[model samples]
Target: MALDRTKDSGNNSSQATGNWKPIGCEEKRAAVHVEMERVNKLPANSSYATHRLRVLNKVLHLISIQRTASQNEELELLFAGISL
Candidate 1:
């Protein structure tokens, strides 16, 4: 009633062992820890924390500008010089 193809096929190899942990588990945990530490180190009402927030705002603004620039025609001109 059942078919036994194992004897018909001469190969007897087994699959290799795979990773036990999910991918990027450690990296995600480290990133969360670092963010938590950064948040804990800065006092809510301190001048230093206010200055750091301003700097981070500037950095985010620049990153948004860079992203917009990358989508423009200048990036096409930049890539024009390179040959595949």
Candidate 2:
């Protein structure tokens, strides 16, 4: 459920479900390379493709954080029960 009410026609909704991890600093640049792997689709060095990949990478990072926080909470609960 992505709500896109903006002047720009292009609106993308990105979300991840299931286990996730923290995306470190290098993840962003590595994402660029991974995106570049699908080179044939885009004209060589297309700026739009580059920007899209960056945006996707950032969204993934955020989603990873969400999953990580949830996992941490679950782990804390488990540990508390064990110590009890």
Judged by TM-score, which candidate is best?
1
The regions of model 2 sitting more than 4 angstroms off are 1-40, 67-84
* Ten-residue region with minimum lDDT total, candidate 1: 10-19
Which stretches of model 1 miss by more than 4 angstroms? 1-41, 66-84
Local accuracy by lDDT, each model = 0.44, 0.49
Residue 60 C-alpha lDDT in model 2: 42
TM-score of each: 0.32, 0.31
lDDT of 1 at 69: 57
**Top-scoring candidate (lDDT):** 2
- Candidate 2 residues 1-84, lDDT tens each? 784444334222122232345455355446545654664388758887676555554444543564577765553443333221
Q: What does the lDDT come to for candidate 2? A: 0.49
Taking all chains together, the TM-score of candidate 2 against the true structure is 0.31
For residue 43, model 1's alpha carbon misses the true position, in angstroms, by: 1.3
